[model samples]
Structures are given as structure tokens and as C-alpha cells.
Target: MTTDDKLVYMANQIARNFEALGHDHAVAATEDHMLSFWDPRMKARILALAVERADALGPVAAAALERLRAGVVPRPQTGATRFAAVDESGASDAG
Candidate 1:
């Protein structure tokens, strides 16, 4: 799969975990997670794919990507403790 596809699948998987929250909440949480965790380049690539193939993304993932692309959500603060809990891509959070 392409990088965009992998990110889409990963985002969808994240959305699935948040699914029980219901549609709107799930999308919001997913978008927040992406803004807080994903690298800027990854976000940009996904945003582009989101525009080109939004229907291919799951509903929640698509909505989240749209919010990211639109600048509706704020990126996490650099010194925020929330980021301490999240490992960067390909990095381990393992003890």
C-alpha cells in the first residue's frame, strides 16, 4: 500500500477505537489525536489524499482529516505534557 493508504488505514483504525463515542465525537477525537500526534508532513499528505479520495476514507477519519486541512483545529503546544505520552511515528512508548 502507498504511504497515503497506510496513513488512511491507520487513521481509520484509530477512528474504530473511538467509534463507541458516536460519529461526531469519534471524528472530533480522531482529529484531535492526529493534530497532537502526527508529524506535519504526514498531516499534509493525508490532507491531500483526503481531498482527492475522501470517500475512500472512513467517515470519521475523513471528517477529522478535513478539520485538519481546514485549520479548524489547533496544533498541540510544543511543551504540552499530552505529547509526552505519545511516541513519535516508528518510535516505541515501551518501558
Candidate 2:
């Protein structure tokens, strides 16, 4: 399968895994999983595909992608953002 096809399959799989949770919950879980695990470039591509070929995505996957594209939810924090930086003098850079 093509790259986009693979992405669609993967997204659909993730959505399907959460399908038992109910609609809203499935959407949230799918979005969370993507945000947590997918690279930014992957998300960008998926977002583009979502706009151009939305019909390919499952219902929950589509809703989750929409939420991501709309920026209505918080992004997952990475290790870099999770801690304060310490300077040479040992002072924390955080606020």
C-alpha cells in the first residue's frame, strides 16, 4: 500500500481499537494516541489527507483528525518540555 494508505490504515486501526469506548471517548482516545505517538510530519500529512480524502477515514478517525487540525485540544508534552532547564549556576530556567 502507498504511504497515505498505510497512514489511513494505521489511523483506522487505532480508532477501531477505541471504538468500544463510545463515540466521544473513542475520538478523544484516538486523538490522544496520535498526538502522543505520531510524529509532527505524520500528523501534518494525515491532516492534509483528512481534508483532501476525508472519506477514507473511519468516523472516529475522522473526528479525531478534525480535532487535531482544528487545534481545539492540548498537545502532548514531550520530554523536552516536561522539565526545567538548569543553567551553569544551577538555577532553574523555568519561570
Per-prediction TM-score: 0.73, 0.76
**Model 2 spans > 4 angstroms off:** 74-95
For 19-91, candidate 2 gives per-residue lDDT tens digits of 9989988898889889888999999999999988888999999999988888767444223434445544434
List of clashing residue pairs for candidate 1: none
Error of 2 at 95 (Å): 34
Per-model lDDT:
0.79, 0.84
TM-score of 2: 0.76
Candidate 2 residue pairs in backbone clash: none
